[model samples]
Target: MEQVTTVGIDLAKRVFALHGADGAGRAVLRRTLRRDQVMEAVAALPPCVIGMEAGSGAHEWARRFRTLGHTPKLMAAKFVAPYRRNGKNDGNDAEAICEAVSRPGMRFVPIKSLEQQALLSLHRVRQGFIAERTGTINRLRGLLTEFGVVLPLRSVIVRRDASKAAEALPGLARRAIDDLLAHLRVLDERIAAYDRELEAQARGCEPAQRLMKIRGVGTLSALAIVATVGDARDFKSGRQFAAWLGLTPRQHSSGGKSRLGHITKRGDAYLRCLLVQGARSVLHTATRHADRMSRWVQGVETRRGYHRALVAIASKNARIAWALLSRNEELRIE
Candidate 1:
């Protein structure tokens, strides 16, 4: 088959599209394989560069391909989208991935190890629980409002006051709200358990421990950052790391002039949210500390509005995390 030099895979749950090309970029193979046949098919090909869009199961497949002496690369789906010549289909997507992987300047996502994936899984599950809990809280509040009972915004207060208010309501309403309150309690316990697990995991990770030394970074943020960005060295600089986190500004330029807009908000929304929330916590207490970081944060907050300051601090912390992880050094307060 002309000794395939490169292959691109369009991955799916049950079916996969494969495109193979030779040294001069001539198509040598185009085939589709079932999930079970993917590894068998790849093992039959000569060692070559394999490319796939960065998506679910891509990292595991990349690891498997590496074991078979093939070089695996994962590109952002958006980057490969530009290479598509025709309507979207598994075959055309495979071809586009093939073309995108061959580009000299193409950026690739780092393949995550099993441990990293496991940590991310924990974060994802915890986030889901949190969202569900919030929905439950809102529903409870709405139900209470319909019954002419107003509750405080704080969850603790709402839970307390709602339980008390339910006593005065009719039997059916009381029963329904009592059930929701019980569910909320269950969610609270689940969320707390997840937090404890993450804390234990962070304590065992030296890098995460080092990250926790930084101001505005707690166990969750530390573990999340370490797990999300496996190796900070993959990024050239902290700014690049922050950019990957979507903490940098979006750009619009024309005729040699540059315009900057709001943040790109491109990657890892959960991680970004954690960082921003941490930054907010820091800003709220910045006045209590006279450190350089606090002073800078206060200055930014005073000059620009609080929202902009919060984002700026979040980006700065992202950069700081990159520096600490890349250099294997502790954060020093100056």
Candidate 2:
């Protein structure tokens, strides 16, 4: 039977380290596998439990392992950190991963699908281009001001008036202005192309369409939620999802009384940032508003102020999103 009951795989770009244990958790197998060798080796052993960290291509491997009759578990890297003994290496990491997977109450990471990773890649790249565009716009505006040519107050105006401003500048400033405009044009084209590609992707997925029903959630939020949560079924409730996003208050407990601190600020920072920004947009742009959630946000804003209000709304939105997704419930703009 070869009797490999538990296995830990330390995954990397090329080579991977493996540690297999018997039913009693005694080390019985230690091996190194090239990327191509991973599947067949595990498949050859009897059905057993397998563990790996949750990052980069982890879900694909998890799916593959399961298909081979293995019970695969994905653990957060932070949860597995306590298992590390001393000097770090693949073998040591594999052992730590194995130990962490055996814990009774440990919360495991949900594996993401290939489509999810692909969509997230598009988002990450688009964000980079957007950031670059912002910097370019700021630089252009500041440089023009130094040359006694000031554009209007708006970003859209600055973009449209660049050529007109350039025409008015003297020779030295004119050439510089033209160079900056060239960069802006390139950035604008790239950003537009990425947006089109993302919109195409969003239309094809039901999860994205569902997410778009929320007040603040737009194309970006819809896509992000769908891609990030490969299986909404894994989350017990919507509040769990909100907590996972670190949208909820931090915990500080002792004795019978429990006090929550500021938000934990854990989990996907980019996702959190997008959700908060979306909340801000909904706060300002929406014309009709009078609901329990909105009223709560209004009250919070009066006491705590704008920044805190923004965070509270973001957290509330996260919770609502989870509820809507997990229950297959529709979003109501309030």
lDDT top scorer: 1
Candidate 1 runs further than 4 Å off: none
Query: CA shift at 257, candidate 1, in angstroms?
Result: 1.5
lDDT of 1 by residue, 220-322 (tens): 9999998888988999999999888899999998999999999999888999999999999999999999988899999999999899999999999999999
Clashing pairs in 1: none
Give the alpha-carbon lDDT of every model. 0.94, 0.84
Clashing residue pairs found in predicted model 2: none
> Could you tell me the C-alpha RMSD of candidate 2 in Å?
3.1
Best by TM-score: 1
The per-prediction CA RMSD against the true structure, in angstroms, equals 1.3, 3.1
Query: Model 2: per-residue lDDT, tens digit, 1-334?
Result: 3588889999899999998888788888889899999988988988888999997778889989988999999987998889999789999999888888887887888777777888999999989988998888888889888878787667799888887878877888888878887988898899899999989888998878888877788898888988887777788876778778888888889898999889888788888998999889766743356776667767788899888888877877777777777788776654
